[model samples]
Target: MLDMFRYNWQVRQDWFEWCRELPQERTGGMGSILATLFHVANGEQIWINSMQGTPVIVKEGVTSLEEAVEFTELTQSITEQFLQSWDDELAMKTLIKKRRDGSEITFTYDKIIKHLIAHEIHHIGQLSIWSREIGRKPVSSDLIFRDY
Candidate 1:
């Protein structure tokens, strides 16, 4: 399961490398690839902090693909360290999330991790479509072929 997170992060890394120079307009469409990427990175950081019983600090504004990749890598590194020391009991722990609208939601540690991975994947699909629409080939999405 954690492997899946790393794999998809690598795919996004590939996307960053592949479309590093894409104009902000193309990448920042309705969903805004950069914004979505920031969401994924920040989401990782936010959730990890939540799991550890700390304040969820969302450092926003990834202005470039390079920054997005770097932020993603940093968050993933912390996440890897956190997961490395995790146990089954930790997976069952719950984290309460407070939305901007003042609503609170709680999720189990394992569920938050799964949701973060799925969230990234959902946006990656959007990035894939954008990549091909611009005549650039998107990264292969097959897990079997993924070397991450």
Candidate 2:
């Protein structure tokens, strides 16, 4: 799980750096680079909170590139803290989470961690598409690119 978190942090940093090189119009427009980043970060937080049987605190919304980058950094820190505090029993235990639409689901801690990483990758793909469409260089976000 720590490895997965590190991989996500690196990919998010790459995306933030790439966004910095884009024109303001491309980076700050509706559904822009920052919006995607914030969405990804918020999704991870929401998932983590749900898996922990805590009330979801991060709200979904659009944000500026700078704000998204900052939020991503904070999210990474919180996730790392949670990972460090997690016990082996908690990692292997199952969690029952209630969905927004009044549905309930069960997932193990390991499964939640996997879903979080997969969700980030999915958003990164969308961000890459947007970056290409806006004439910016999209960073490679593949896990294999990360050392260790």
Compare the candidates by lDDT and give the number of the best one.
1
Per-model TM against the reference: 0.84, 0.81
Question: lDDT per residue, candidate 2, 1-148, as tens digits?
Answer: 7888888889888888887776673543336667767777888887777666667765666456777777777778778877887778878989886789999988888888888888887877887787788776689876776773
Off by over 4 Å in 1: 21-25, 28-31, 99-103
* True-structure lDDT of candidate 2: 0.77
Tell me the spans in candidate 2 whose CA falls farther than 4 Å from its real position. Answer: 25-30, 53-55, 60-62, 86-88
lDDT of each: 0.77, 0.77
Which one wins on TM-score? 1
Error of 2 at 45 (Å): 1.0
